[model samples]
Target: MANRLECVDVGTEYCPCYLAELNECIVCSQLQGKKFCDCNWKGVCVFQEFVWAGYKAKVTRSTVFTRILKKEEINEEVVILTLKVPNKLARDLNEPGAYVFVRGYFSPSFFDTPMSVMWADEIEGIIKIAIQVTGPKTKFIASAKEGEEVYLRGPYWNGMFGQRYIKGMHNSKALVVLRGIAQAPGVIVILKLIQNKNKVIVLLDKGKVQTNFIKDYIKNSDVTLVEADLLSEEGQEVLKQFIKDKKISVIYSGGSDEQHINILEYMDKYESEAYLAVSNNNKICCGEGICGSCEIEIDGQKMRTCKVQVDIRKMLERKMSRG
Candidate 1:
């Protein structure tokens, strides 16, 4: 059985810098016996709910402003948020497949939502994230106005596809399969790969592709976007043909659990390199691992993405070691 961790443990100490407003802790380390004073009042506990080790910051609190540059309606259910962040934050997000945790206040509750940086321009200090209206947090983000300021914590490095991984994929057939909004992390990675001159084959759902909201942004792009029901037999045949004919070297699959599993099975069959995104339903109170939420298993070892630097290349390493 895989060991798992849940935040707000009954008898464990947590980081002091844990931001209550965001419902996320700042520490990315394992929470076992760990403590820090976020208030820095000589280790005096600021909040009765959590206790931590005492540490002082020059500025006790700082908020990075995410100004909405534009909001485009992809469809009734999906929206794209274009935001301008500080230059320093943009530099941290230079890599493809990076993500940020957003803190937006809604009617009854506040949320810290993890959104993949669909696209980032370091020079322009801009990043784009696409959101599908499935949950309350997303709905709040979609309701944000162009000039509104949204609280954002990080361009978190964990669980990101590394630059070396992208550089290594030269002159090889790359196929990306995406299903629901949950698997949207592949968007920026695919865009970057295509910009690097890789002729990427994107397999997306027919309904999602046909919708003007999502399709308009993707239309007329240099990449080849193929719309199909990837779960169907014909879809499998098409995928197989592309893998065989194009000599696909790497296949990246995201979206629902079913899509991830199907692609992994397919990769195992063909012995192709498989980079699949695994979603954890654990409460991510902190995108930082300190919260102990969002822990996952790798070769029977429990690790948290927020705590460790996860790379697509490591997935292959884990698979090889298991075999």
Candidate 2:
């Protein structure tokens, strides 16, 4: 009934976890506690076992699909990726806009950073995530081809705020900001939301190309489409105007410090109601909670952003920091 997380330690390796594969083992590796934290697998498993025993969630066959939206010099490493968790494993995850844990290895080519899911297509029995190859773990994920099942175990994290909060937006005009490229978790969130009620989704994107993704979703629905052809002061004002109502929330998918600053000022005017999907930079070493690397304070509570997107805690901090 309650939520839980679990992971299997493949071997006797110390917790200097940095995408334990090769090549990247020496490049910006975390073998010396520079990045990774130790996890008590038994404790985690026990917690999971106590909470949800015989919990049926398995990634039977992960075929790396090449269906991705790529970018040139995609520093954010947004790789449009798709993976499938077994039907049994996915059944328990009835929550829409929730993420299940993945058990897999970091590719030898890229740096170290575990990939995370953005959303689920429960009806199709498929779980999807938009991942960015920022490090070793991600590189492996980006390179993983069709039929290659990655070793992973979990349905660790759920949707943000819960269905009640999401449903609240059902009748309002909302903003979905896309600030990430390549393989970002937001892609999952974006895809699932486009399926929302006709007016539930709002697309706030800049530029000709990026704005196109927003336009397509908006034109199809009655959702308001505000295109920031250029991220200007004018653009910020346009987005700010939409964040005022109670049913409306903003999702910042991609951006720079400048864009973040623009958002900070905008969110400050609104307070706790502002919603932001994690930036592509958020490093999630273990898709499960075993790795505390992705811990981010949301509303003063530390939560794993990879598993937990759509937060307001740090948005306040960011807003205050700018002030």
Candidate 3:
């Protein structure tokens, strides 16, 4: 059987995006140049939206200049940026898996770097993101001074897969494992889980960034915090024990591909039925799915990781096979 694919933006106002015009719509078979409709989507029809818009894609997300409210240098390698945006934008990005493309205002569009929404305050009209200075693009962002304006294009919500579980699961227990700078995105995930009334436990490893930057964010929240080196045998034992004892219903892995694989391995070893969600980890040059840099093959289908709702199990299978 063919793998069922879901586009992150399918039912949103951003539906019938540029992909539809190119006959490459992720969820619509008819829009993919097929003669008949065979989409699994039960919401508004993407093809109908495309036709209603006169065979054109709807308006794409616009780039805007946002003022930097604050910048906190966590360490030599990491910085947290708080930007002032519109209230609506902040609210839209308050959910799990939200991310945006950011660049220094004076830089060219190619300098745009994707960063997850670490924290968002709708009432305050502000959003915070953590940037690790890994390369030129991030270095430019890191150099951005306070009170300066930065270009942002987003409200993108596919930073991670398994968003359904993140948004829908409640009154259950969840375990979030975050390492290095990957801890940035884990904040919104934890917040959303907490908002859903789920019992949340976080296993944090500062990894290469070498600082537990998120400590301040969740300190007041009702969450159990465990700091451990996830790569060590002792940490592995702790993780396995948590799975076996906590009876966690959902697990989110916020780290490198190796960490994701490790968590998946333990889940299987314990015969865990917990739902798994992991960071996208794909090269996302364009958040709009136009660049094709984020494309990956899963179950014989090519999917753009930037917008596709990938199955965590199949994604892990592909990663393990590549090793």
- Write the residue-wise lDDT of candidate 3 on 1-323 in tens digits: 67668889988888889989899888999988999999899998888899899999997898999999999998899999999999999999998999999999899988988999999999999999999999999999999999999999988999999999889999999999999999999999998898898889999998999999998888645699999988899988888888775479999999998888988888888888999999989888887788899999886888899999888888888989989
Q: Rate the local accuracy (lDDT) of all candidates.
A: 0.57, 0.43, 0.91
Residue 54 lDDT in model 1? Answer: 32
Estimate, for each residue in 1-323, the C-alpha lDDT of model 1 and write its tens digit: 32232222112232343443233432322222236433223332334434233332112223466789999886788788888988767766655546777766333224777777766777898888878777778888888988888887675644443334554666555777666664456666676566676767777764343342334444434567776777688887877665554366566665554554556666667766534444322345666455567665565666665544343334445544565
Q: Going through the candidates in order, what is the number of backbone clashes in each? A: 8, 26, 0
Best by TM-score: 3
Lowest summed lDDT across 10 adjacent residues in model 3 is found at 215-224
lDDT of 2: 0.43
TM-score of 3: 0.98
TM-score preference between candidates 1 and 2, better one:
1
Better model by lDDT: candidate 2 vs candidate 3:
3
Candidates 2 and 3 compared: the better one by TM-score is: 3
Each candidate's TM vs. the true structure? 0.68, 0.54, 0.98
The global Cα lDDT (0 to 1) of model 3 is 0.91
